[model samples]
Target: MNTVIDAHNISKVYNPTTIPVYAVNNVHLHLQKGEFTALVGPSGSGKTTLLNMIGGLDRPDEGNIFINGIDITKLSANELISFRLQNIGFVFQSFNLIPVLTAKENVEFIMQLQKASKQQREERVKTLFAQIGLQDKLNERPSRLSGGQQQRVAVARALASRPQFVLADEPTANLDTKSAFNLLDIMAKLNMEENITFLFSTHDQRVIDRARRVITLVDGRIVQDTAEVSTQHEEAAAVKT
Candidate 1:
């Protein structure tokens, strides 16, 4: 698989002169096309900080970030924003869906920003919703949908721009057991069948078990990196316990 993202000696800090805190230490990580990985860590372990840098939501104080071989670290603010929209998708912990928009509209929002045609947007939304088992709730607004339903819709929206990769921060944190399993099923299926690349920060054991690659971060540094794990079918089954 081609390398989709590369971070070299990345670091981020806040309040350098005062009570200095390193949100992300000199950490390095990479992701490949069609890879499903989980960034597991304790609270304040720098998972979100690393994700924000990769997604271009924030710039690291030191080190370089390259996505698709493009050195994102060199891009200006405006350029970075444009590049991110064209290349990366983000699913925040909060659904962040517009209250007034229906599920279809929410998914169409990003495509609209990309100036995609109505037909194209509709086609993509229809296919994604069906794949995620949300075909019937297409017309429902976030307020009307359950938390899981809303999260599924958010995932669909993340794919609206057809980004190379999706970054999900604690995606299943607010869901019940059934909802979490359902969402995981959709995500794992998308990774296996559609070859959608996903890199999410999660503390859920179930989510961790489902990931093909598990990267553990501790105190802003990567302490363990496990890749090339075997098929997780058995693990997934056991996690449903």
Candidate 2:
């Protein structure tokens, strides 16, 4: 598999001169295409900071980040903005949507920014909404939908641009158990079917259990990076042995 994201010696400090708080320090990471990964850590472990650095939302004080071999840290403001728009999809905990826009409109917004054809945008929104079980709610605005539905729409919106990898920060933070499972099932299905890479930052065990790979961070350093096997796998192995 191709390396979709490469972070080399990344370091970020809140205040360098006086009482420096190192948010992230010497972090080296790489993500392969189609991999579903979660960065789990305690509060202030630099998960969000590292995620921001990878997403081009924040710049690191030192080191470089590469997406598909392009050094994003070296790009100009406009260039980086364009790159991020085209390559990365972001899903924040807030489910940021235009208040007045319908779910369909919200999902279409990304492709509109990409200058995709109207036919393409419409087709994608239709398919994505259907895939996420939101086809019936297409005309409804965000305020009209439930928390779970809103998050589903947000997931649909993230995939609208057909980005290389999706960065989701606390995607299921507000969902109930059923909703969270539903969202995770949808995302996992999409990952398998479309081979879309997903890198999410979360602390929830439900999210952690669903992830294929778990990367744990402690005090801004990755303490654990290992492939994850589901409970079903463990049970099956026990029976076999």
Candidate 3:
């Protein structure tokens, strides 16, 4: 598989005073195209920091990061911004929707940034809203929607740009069990149907069970990496027996 994102000997340090805090230490990771990966760790484990570095929101102090074969560490600020807009989408724990914007408007905003035509943006947003089962909530503002509904809107906005990769930071942290599972189901379908790669930083077992691969981090370093066979594949093997 082609590598969508690659990191080598990456490290991040936060200078609070005279002492520097090592947030990430010598971490290396490679995400293949179409892969669904979970980064699981306890508090202060640096999973979010790693995701931010991969998403170009932050820079690594000690190493290089390449996304789609381009070394983003070498890019200028303007270049990095453009690269992020064109290649990556992000879903946050807080469902970072503009509260005043309607669901449809929130979804259309990113496409507008990409300079998509008004008609194209409208059509795309309509399709996405319908796909995420949010068509009825199109005119609702973030404040008007339930937590799950707002998150569905966030998911729609992330896919608005048709990005190659989506980085989700604790996407299920605020949801109830039913809502969390629903969001995971939508993401899983999107991953399979659109071939969009997803990387998540989560401690939730629900999210971990859905991932095709899981990377466990401890004390700022990856301690274990494992791949699980998909349920569909497992069922097929059983049927052939």
Cα lDDT, all candidates? 0.91, 0.92, 0.92
Candidate 2 CA-lDDT value: 0.92
> Residue-wise lDDT of candidate 3 within 77-185, one digit each (tens)?
9999999989999999999999989999999989999999999998998889878998889999999999988998999999999998999999999999999999999
Q: Considering summed lDDT, which 10 consecutive residues are worst modelled in model 2?
A: 226-235
Compute the lDDT for candidate 3: 0.92
* TM values, all candidates: 0.93, 0.93, 0.92
lDDT (10s digit) by residue, model 2, range 146-224:
9899999999998999998999998999899999999999999999999999999999999999998999999999888
Return the candidate ranking by lDDT, descending. 2, 3, 1
Candidate 3 accuracy as TM-score: 0.92
Compare the candidates by TM-score and give the number of the best one: 2
Task: Please say which candidate is ahead in lDDT: 1 or 2.
Answer: 2
lDDT of 3 at 43: 91
Clashes of each: 0, 0, 0
What candidate 2 gets wrong by more than 4 Å, as runs, is 227-241
Q: How many Å off is the CA of 182 in candidate 2? A: 0.6
- The order by descending TM-score is 2, 1, 3
Task: Give RMSD to native, each candidate.
Answer: 5.5, 4.0, 4.1
